[model samples]
Target: MSSRSILLTGASGFLGSVLLRRLSTLEGNSVVAAYRSGKDEGDCASGVLSLGPIDGNTDWSDAWARPVNLVIHAAARVHVMSESEGDPLAAFRKVNVDGTLNLARQAANAGVKRFIFISSIKVNGESTPLGKPYTADDTPAPLDPYGISKHEAEQGLLALAVATGMEVVIIRPVLIYGPGVKANMRSMMWWLCRGVPLPLGAIDNRRSLVAVDNLVDLILTCLEHPAAANQVFLAGDGEDVSTTGLLRRMGASLGHPARLLKVPSGLLQQVAGWAGKEAVAQRLLGTLQVDIEKNRRLLGWSPPVTLNQGLLSTARHFLESDQT
Candidate 1:
């Protein structure tokens, strides 16, 4: 493959930051780090072209005046506490739907070869029922505002591709984790670091998680892989781990024994709902597993980093950040 100019949205975010670093080290690749605010000077690499703030007001045609061979649409209104409190549907649509459509239209006009969308597995559903996992062929039935927005974005992108003869690739990853992770995963890491005992040892719900590196590798593969075009893939580490198992592994990575006690799931759910953390509880204790056989067979991609290695790397990052 020849050198490609790739525009990466959300370059300062957790996943984007990791992708930016990886892209910086790759040969024959130029990156444009699109931010929704001021440039992150500390995280910007030598080859990264920093462009600030791309919202509804920003003229994308002008912003994307330069030739961009590929676009990885990673920027979106992520699901968080502050976001969920507001009109979540509208808020998510503003960025995940509108922003994505704007960029795809501009990319199409610019004759960009491929548009890679970083969607969430929540587009399928929140949880997988017993004895079944979600596959790419399954119809999307998003359960929340965030998931709905991503599904809408996927539809828009696919429509644009069909109309313009462009290629679109959608990657729905489940619970991505690694260095610089935030939200509940970060909280979990913090608790484990402090050796705080958790009452989640009894939960046997299985969830699929993908490492940052694995996701990045898949993104790169989709950039050039012919089979990836006009395809949707569910990606993960191919190993489902329960909440308790994950905690134990995390403790092992941090060089500490797992500090967890058996707690009834129903009681925990009630307490979480009382505390206005029902969503958090569901995610932490939910059984959302994804089947990655399609991605494996289609792209021939497997997670490069194992669960243990990924956990250790994340633990090391927390340690380093704490010291600094």
Candidate 2:
């Protein structure tokens, strides 16, 4: 591969940071990382560019000073556990939808060959019935504000691609786990480390997840592959795991076996509903698997790292970081 000039957004985020580091170390990749913090004075020691807060009005003149051949947009208003905004949908649309289209329009005008958008499986729906997995061909049915925003952004990007002739690649990945992971995944690790007995053994809901390494690999593939242009793909590890399976595996990786007490799924759901935590319970006891056959058929890609390998890496990082 010849030297390719690539610009990446969300350089400071969990997924973006990993992708930035990987791109920076690869040979023949002239990578420029774009972040949303204006506090940093000029370019940093690592050559990351600060674009301030990303929104519809954010400027990208500095990034376009040099020719950028490709763009990987991984930044967005991610889902929050405690949303404080008065209008949650409007808030998400401001960043995920508006901010994304703003960047895409500029990228098209600047003659960028490809723009890769990192989307979420929520676009398909919240949960799936047994034996049914979400595929790229299915009609989008985003339920929440965040998923709606991403779906709208995808539609806008595809329309822009048709009008401006700039190729667009959309990837919808399920729950991603790896080193430096936070939120529920990290919480699970913490509980396991403390040897807390969780009443989640009887829950038998299948879920799909992607490793950071596997997702990054797919992103790199979409960056240049002719087949990836103007296409949407679902990404996963191909192997589905239940809630109990996930906890047990994570616990094993952390050197602490999960102590799960078998509890009826119905009782857990009912109790969670009464406490206004139905969403959280559904996540734990819901089936949300994705089919990644498109990725394999089109790009000939499969998750290079297995689920166990990814979990082990996350556990090792958690241990090292916790001790420090």
59-177 in candidate 2: lDDT tens per residue? 98788888898999998999886899999999999999989999999998888999999999989999998779999989999999999999999999999999999999999989999
Report backbone clashes per prediction.
0, 0
lDDT of 1 by residue, 188-278 (tens): 8788878888999999788899999889998988999989999999979888899999999988887767899899988999999999998
The superposed Cα distance between candidate 2 and the true structure at residue 129, in angstroms, equals: 0.9
Candidate 1 minimal-lDDT segment of 10 residues: 41-50
Candidate 1 ranges with C-alpha deviation above 4 Å: 42-53, 82-85
Best-fitting candidate, scored by TM-score: 2
lDDT of 2 at 237: 91
Cα error of candidate 1 at position 250, Å: 0.1
TM values, all candidates? 0.94, 0.97
Q: What is the C-alpha lDDT of each candidate?
A: 0.84, 0.90
